[model samples]
Target: MQDYLELFFNLIKQPIIQAVLCVIGSILAAKIADWIIGRVLSNLANRTSSTIDDNIIQILHRPIYYSILFIGLGISVKAFSLPEVLSFVLLGLFKTIAVIIWSFALFQSFMHFITWYGRQGKKDNVF
Candidate 1:
């Protein structure tokens, strides 16, 4: 029994297993986040008159989901005792993905706000 328990512990400590676990955990987290955003946040956004909130919510949904995924992936990659160059490259790739996703989301939100502002101005005859 003791030997079996030791072997199990050793297997669990393997880098590949740890990485897979991290990915699975991240995926589950992303799903939960998506569910909350789709059901609860969307309902709240719909209750409001302005569509700006809705747009913001829409812009945020995917980036937030991907961010969680990337975070998990980064952690998983770091769990492996990778060589310095490979580790650096992988971490950099994950960071780049995060930056791109967030920047795109912000750009989209900005565009939506500008459109809404323009509509308001037109309605008020300010422009």
Candidate 2:
């Protein structure tokens, strides 16, 4: 048993293995985030009087997932010990993608809120 445990530990010490584990961990984290937003947060949002909160939560789910995924990927890339320039570029790319995704989500959520507010105003004859 000790021999097997030692072998497993040795294998896990490899950079490639570590990188793969990081990627897998990131995916799992993203999925957990999705589940939380979909199941737990959705339930909370549903209890609210306004649907805007629900829509905002739904919009945020993907951005949050992809942000976590990109961060992990960036770490994995660094684990490979590539040239500094290459690592910098790859990390920058991941950071850019995360920013873009979050920006898009924020824009979408804001638009949804604006539209909902407009509808409410119309219903109240405040328009």
Candidate 3:
């Protein structure tokens, strides 16, 4: 038993193994998050009268998934310990991706809000 444990620990210590595990874990985590959001929170949101909750839920999927993926990729990059220039470029790319994901989500949420507001105004005869 102790020998098996030691072997397992040794295997986990390798950088490549660590990187792979981190990536796999991140993917699983993101999937779990998506499931929870889609199955659990979605039901809760559906119970509400407002479309805003539903729209917000829909907007959240990409940012959440990409954020998790980027975090894993960043960790894996460090584990590999490549050239400084390469590492810097890779990290920058990841950051850019993250920023784009969140920015699009924000833009989409804002659009949904505007649409809802317009409908409200129309219903109230205020527009």
Q: Highest lDDT, which number?
A: 1
Point out where model 1 deviates above 4 Å: 1-8
Clashes of 1: 0
Error of 1 at 42 (Å): 0.7
TM-score versus the correct structure, for each prediction: 0.88, 0.91, 0.92
Query: What is residue 101's positional error in candidate 2, in angstroms?
Result: 1.0
TM-score of 1: 0.88
How would you encode candidate 2's per-residue C-alpha lDDT over 6-41 as one tens digit per residue? 999999999999889999999998899889989999
- Candidates 2 and 3 compared: the better one by TM-score is 3
Q: Model 3 residue 14 lDDT? A: 93
- The true-versus-predicted C-alpha distance at residue 37 of model 1, in Å, is 1.0
Evaluated at residue 78, the lDDT of candidate 2 is 75
lDDT agreement of model 1 with the native: 0.94
Instruction: Estimate, for each residue in 42-63, the C-alpha lDDT of model 3 and write its tens digit.
Output: 8999999989989999898879
lDDT of 3: 0.91
Q: Is candidate 1 or candidate 2 better by lDDT?
A: 1
Candidate ranking (TM-score, best to worst): 3, 2, 1
